[model samples]
Target: MTSVSRYMSYRGYQFPMLKYWSPSLGVTMLGVVGAILFLAMTLGPKPYYWPTDASYGSSPPIATRAGWMALALLPFVLGLSVKANMISVLTSIPHEKLQIFHHWTSYAMFLLALIHTFPFIIYHIDKGDMVKQWKTSLVYWTGIGAIIPQAYLTIMSLPFIRNRFYEFFKATHMIAAVVFIVFFFLHCDFRLSSWDYFIASGIIYFLCLSFSQVRTYLMHGIHTATLELLPSGLARVSVPTVIKWTPGQHVFVRFLTPDLHLLTAHPFTISSVYRDPDQAGKAPELAFYIKPRRGVTARLAALAAKQTGITKKILIEGPYGGVSTHHMSQFDTILVIAGGSGGGFSLAMVDEALRVSGLHTGEDESGQESRRRLQVVFSTRDTPMADWYIDEIESRLSQSTTLPGSDNGFETSVSVHITSKPDLTRSTSTLDSEKGTAGKLPPTDITTTGSFSLNIYRNARPDIPGLVARTVAMAHANPMPNGKKQRIGVLVCGPASMLHDTRNAAALAQKRTFGGEIEELYLHSESFA
Candidate 1:
């Protein structure tokens, strides 16, 4: 889908539109729920009445139908719960992107579960055997057992609670899920075909779990990760490995250290592009730029602060979820926007752009001269982070400039904005901001480094919409030589606020594409928070 359709929202409800579902996703989910309800209501007992036979007890036709419907949803819910699964492999959709569906499906199952439970309770009460059934029936006990954990899983999984108590929630979520599944299986008591659902779900969940475990422990194996504290208070993790990963992908790192997130595996985006060891004459390294928060990052930062370049044994899983390299190459122009810690994401995109355009290898592709343009816009409140970013950009630009085919017309530009007040006392040679007549921090434009231009602004925020519009306008101004409309790809990684702005901006830019001014306007957004 184009950015326009993906980010489309109804008037007067912009905030709610940003919560989870896009209009397309919302409609798809609505259809799913509607179909479930239709089947439940249509196939069930007409008045949802309790059977006259006392032997039937709480096993009314309607209750059985509701239970069966809930059972049918098990496979999908379980399949989407894992990081590595057949669903993702077969569908070409990443596990993370399927997370929203996983959550919604579970909610639907819980609702059906409630529907299945209430009927039994009402039937038992009407028959005046509620107390007897509660005391004697294993089914009643096991049903309640399953529901307690299910309720906990549902309520605790809410965004606010899950994000606020993430460490606690993550630790307990797995345990609770196992308990709920076990009790749910027992509650079914091998009722015809019920065991089938359990087996399906069990297989799907275990297979994915086993694959992830094997990849983490046996395939990628254990490696030493060196942690260094940057002046920006960000932790830089460097790991040498033969494993290759696409740009914009992330890996879950499990540190083998006690009292320091020993049991948890935290995900970090790889900031460096992978190259062949044989070709480069050394093992390729993966780098992560992590802003210290709480838990694992906080502990890692503390250790790095004590002694720079501290090494820790770590297990890595994945390299998952990235825009396809081929898809990215199809774009005539690539604009990357990042905020704070999202610098890593932006850096990776820039690296990929350079590599794809043959600027890094100095190999000129036939008929590809001046074919691609890359723009990077990064905003941060910290000056040190901005400085670090500037240095990294300069290094890349310098390398490209010295290459044989560097002047192939593959244009690159970087803009860094620091929202906080600049420290005038710091000694730096790159600062080129003109002195303000009043007490104001004016925008600073750093001198062009090598063949690329680098601009830095102090005490200012980026105009996200303006940047997007200008990039699209530039692409429109330079029509493709092939007589085809130009394509622009925008990648945004930042906090929710920044994502919201970029999302809307990209969506609005789609108007030009729809009006035949361009071929396409694609947007990929990642939320760092």
Candidate 2:
């Protein structure tokens, strides 16, 4: 296999385990090219994808321009595919292929875009007519905006940042991308390429995103929700979606307007469910904690703020992420590490863990029978979001007493690390005691023998050395309740920093136990930022 092939097959995105039929990137590209080619052949000449001098506009100049332009577009398209294809699905294409294309092609695209624009600019400059310049003006600036961010996103998509300083890159990429795509569409005027195809591309991506949303909404619901605030700026809204979702599974949501019919959806794992305290049914109602930020969410917030009720519908799709939750019941104890609204996710699993076999104690409290230890280390800088979270925590705490399995009950500990704002200095100092939790819960010295974790850079993301050491410590200190060696699964969702650290920690832990082979493994990673 070629180096490019290797990169595509393995080095790109972290493929989440799922059972959906997703097409391979190679297949998708081939199909797209086929569509483009057929159109070009049918149309004959101008704007044709492939070339021949006399018949089609495949002159060396157009060919070079098109080829380079395609390359420049590679990063944006590839990067988008990578983001959209976050779940490790059953695709003819493995997750890595497009990433490779996205990475390498991005450079080619950047240079090609420059080629396409500069020559046109230079030729136009000689005429120097203000009216003529204004005519071609709109898309140039917009396309440039799109290109600049696409270029930066491509640079950071490298494994170094993609896997290492992922938090910053992820946030940067998402923010840049939303802005870029908006500009991208406007910049073109849909004149050069087949307008239908360009529109089709928008539809293609939107379809994937919309399908996920509609599915999720139908399954989850968009009405009657009580928003509770947790301690860490985490807001948990429990709505009754008639849909039943599996544990360790997730879905996409879009709560906009007629735009929801066109725009992409935001992804989130269901944090709490009411269907199966035992998780016995195929369907269930759920609760989700949302960390309000820019992008899709900010708009959702604006809509909510203006709303008189829960009429804003969110499109939801997928019973995606076939993450194994069996160990949840089998482990001696389950340790969950969550940040901000991520704590809501813990509540979902934690409620179930209390009832699962090994994790539960023999004694039945109030005759319901339950005993499971779930520790949530929640940290937040005092903000309006934090206020929202505190309200949720109080409500959940009040409701926890009634959750079937929680009769004997699990203790819900809220760790509020507040300072001025996003300052890592004084805040990190206060949070220092939370050192040895799964992804920084609390030091084992302050906690018990059942579980422990390591902190994920409360300041700047932990460097590689710090991460390696943290992974080592967590590996060595893995709590194996009842003194038995067992498989410990990890499901992390929050900032990209925690995901990276958790992934590395999980990997090393597996290696520490079995000779470098992942055993009984299930990892589900999602980034809210």
Query: After superposition, which runs of candidate 1 have C-alpha atoms over 4 Å from their true positions?
Result: 1-13, 16-45, 51-57, 359-369, 425-450
lDDT of 1 at 287: 97
TM-score of each: 0.89, 0.50
Candidate 2 residue-wise lDDT, 422-490, digit = tens: 432322222221223231222221322212221222222223324333433443454333433334444
lDDT of 2 at 409: 42
Which candidate number has the best lDDT? Answer: 1
TM-score of 1: 0.89
lDDT of 1 by residue, 354-403 (tens): 77666333222434334577889999998788878877866765665575
Give each prediction's root-mean-square deviation over alpha carbons.
4.0, 11.5
Cα lDDT listed for each candidate: 0.79, 0.47
- What is the RMSD, in Å, between candidate 1 and the native fold over all Cα? 4.0
Pairs of residues clashing in candidate 1:
none
Cand. 2 Cα-lDDT: 0.47
Distance from true location, Cα of 80 in model 1, Å: 0.3
Candidate 1 lDDT trough over 10 residues, lowest sum? 432-441
